[model samples]
Target: MKRKLRSGITASLLAVTACMALHSPQSLAARDAQTILKETCQGCHTPEADNALSRISHQRKTPEGWLMSIARMQTMHGLQISDDDRRTLVKYLADTQGLAPSETDGVRYALERRLNTVEKFDDQTSQMCGRCHSGARVALQRRPAQEWERLVNFHLGQWPSLEYQALSRDRDWFDLARKEMVPLLAKRYPLDNPAWKKWQASAPKAQAFVGDWNFSGHLPGKGELAGVMSVTADGDDTFKVSVKGQYADGSPFNGDGSAILYTGYEWRGNVTIDGVTMRQVFAAQGSAMQGRMFEAEHDERGLDFVAAKQGSSRLLAVQPGYLKAGTETEVTLIGSGLSGKPNFGKGVEVLEVVEQSPDRIKLKLKAAANAQPGLRSVMVGSLKGPTLSVYSTIAEVKVVPAFSVARIGDGGGSTPKVQGRFDAEAWGKGADGKLYRIGVFPAQWKVEPFDDRAREDEDVKFAGTMQADSGVFTPGDAGPNPERKMSTNNAGNLKVIAAVDDSGKSLTGEGQMIVTVQRWNNPPIP
Candidate 1:
């Protein structure tokens, strides 16, 4: 079955309000994690022997997981809590009872809204739970066997259709869930892991991000970018962030937004640049931070952002980071503490230094026509970091995402249309006989029918429009189309194709896109 990346939550999920002073300074300060927990949760959650509350005490989760829990409380348990109090509870629970950084390493895709990720899991877990939601969703939490069993019960009790689903109907779903899944989940992700204990005892304070930072990223439609971000403390775990930089084309990239640090390292920021609102989901560790930042509304359009604090002298990236083996071009090295002589490895010659700075170094360079095609390490002074590709010919062009999903909406409705973004990644075989990724290159985009059914149904004409130069696929409007047979909604299977011209040679890559209906169940996690 084709996997649809973008899904939605129902309107019934919890609503978290914007961050602001909803109460007096004294009142807010008085309502710490413990105080709010006692007043809000003590009614339903029984106190344990060690002063821990039931259910919540036995599990560890990310900030989003906790938020979902509170949202569920409001929807299913008649728990009426203010937005301010809910936010406080989420922070407190996440910080004190959250997963360790190591625990969240591989699952950051779910948090970053890289919704296109194809999940892999053991058969029992995948078929039993992940068939409906993400396996990452289950892997994100650490729970005891008892809690896992309780969760299984909750699933069957809440959604009584559990036994009627395709895979579930073939067997004793409840027996397998309790007997097989409970033990598997418990052993795989135990509540008493040592990483959690260590993290809880030594996690850094939220103020760690109060300083200047060097950042670099790439947005699909908008070229490469590098800049500096300044952060300041706003409230308890909240921050005020400002970014100043420019795209590779010298276009200014400036914005300011508020941020909230959850579980010490999770950095969530909302900034607006040139009137476009963007959100940052980064992990801060000491002086370095990295993550993806996307437009809050249209998440498909985003940048893979990486940043280092101002103090580090590490080389971050090379803007316009590629050069044709026989061509001369100007490229900027964006980093910290760039000095001394500059080098671009073997085949590249530094003709002149266009600009130099402590944070940036611009140089005019040329690659020999006989340059061995591969990624060349860039160096500035003694510090060695960052790499740019040198290739004479495009060996192959592969669409970045081999498969994805786009939604049909914005036809006078609450849910907006989800666009399908694509990038053409060029690769070359080096002298050592390894396929090295050159980088994202310009391409002409088009769509065709995926199968004979799609062709017979005229899906290409009715599904959507693919931008030629930008590779942006915007799906058609929602509701039934009178022109299509049966007047069906504008949903169809499409073959996304990209044509690239390297020098004079043409290369093409193809991917799959499912333009489908609206998903009303969008939530913070999914």
Candidate 2:
């Protein structure tokens, strides 16, 4: 059997809430890991005669990893433990058995919840392993060949329908995994590495981040933002963080939050930015940090964030971030200690420095008709700034939130339709054969069914309408609609298309959007 009950329970768990508070403050007093596991988990996670736990003892993971595992046990296997006990057990396992810092470097992106991260794997591994989940999930582990082989067996045994899935149906998945994959994975990720040994011998007693840092990031559709952050230790591994920054438009933005570091490197924070709550997932390594920041409510909207130790002079951000070929555009450079005439990297010409300050510089910058396109470094005197992108003819236009979801508004005197926004950007191929961004541009917006089946079902007409000038979709109200399949809510899978005029040519790009039902109990970490 495929363990349908577990699958349904997991779906419910994930769909409903990302964080579960199952214990009161009084119940969270520290307890021995052995006692808690024996009382709540031993019924299924039976200990061997050696007094060692079965699968739990063999595996090592970050606190978040252990939390997910325990949550699965609670939901699927009927394990029961107070919230305090669960927290205590997770800490015990992570502190004693977590991967070293170096071991976590590759998969930190996964833990940080960064969007659009590409996982690298060889062709064999990609087909054999990544066909189901991320390759980073594989890279995050260390095991012997025998153990890897057994894990493959576990997958097949737990989900007997694996062999019938699209990726495995036509291939000898079981045989190849047993023979080729086991050895490849074992050799690739041996348990003992020299770096880990060195780190363990001299690892600092505490590696809490407690200082001011400078940060810069790009928010898709919102342009570039630069800021300074102050972090102070709030607990052994928790922090209080404050941020002060501005968007490219010079609008002041400020945020305050708290964070908890799990496994020493993973920093997860809940904060409010620009009057809206947001979550931050960043990794700290020595004097540098980088990660993703997104809305606490809707994770689909996120951006890249990076920071370096404070007190250094560097370029932090470039407003608009890109220049259209042969067009004169005003650019703002946000940074610290900026001086002298700025160099606009290659293929860019500065007409005049409009204004100057230690932290802000505005200039009229232009790219020649034949200028090279792509991200180029910015420099002013000894201070280096963020990158600027340039592009010529609009080779393409892509709508962001490529795959989007929106829910209809509740009909109890509320607006009849929920609005979803979209932004379109133009892009051009650079000399290096890579696509260079041309930034957002005004475009004609339209919506259509994602496929022929959706088109025949008239989804675009019943589900929503795309506001041509603004690129926003207003979805129909929620209810059982007899027009839709199964008489469900007015939901749809749609393609948002953007068309822009470049010189005399018209270019178009499309992205996926889905209008669905409302989500209850949306959690910050989901």
Q: Against the true structure, whose TM-score is highest?
A: 1
Question: Residue by residue across 1-526, what tens digits does model 1's lDDT show?
Answer: 1222221132223332322211111135346778777888999998898889999899998877887888788766878877767777877787888888899988888878887778878788789888888888888999999999999999999889889998999999999999988999999989899988888788788777788898899988678999999999888777788999888778998998888888888777788877898878888888789999888778788889988788778788887778989899998888777779888889899999989988888899999999988898888889888788998777888986889899999878777899999899998888888888888998999999999999999999988999999999999999888999999989999999999998788899999999999866766677
lDDT of prediction 2: 0.71
Give stretches of model 1 more than 4 Å off.
1-30
Worst 10-residue lDDT window, candidate 2: 18-27
Error of 2 at 239 (Å): 0.6
> Against the unseen true structure, what C-alpha lDDT does each candidate score?
0.83, 0.71
lDDT score, candidate 1, position 272 = 89
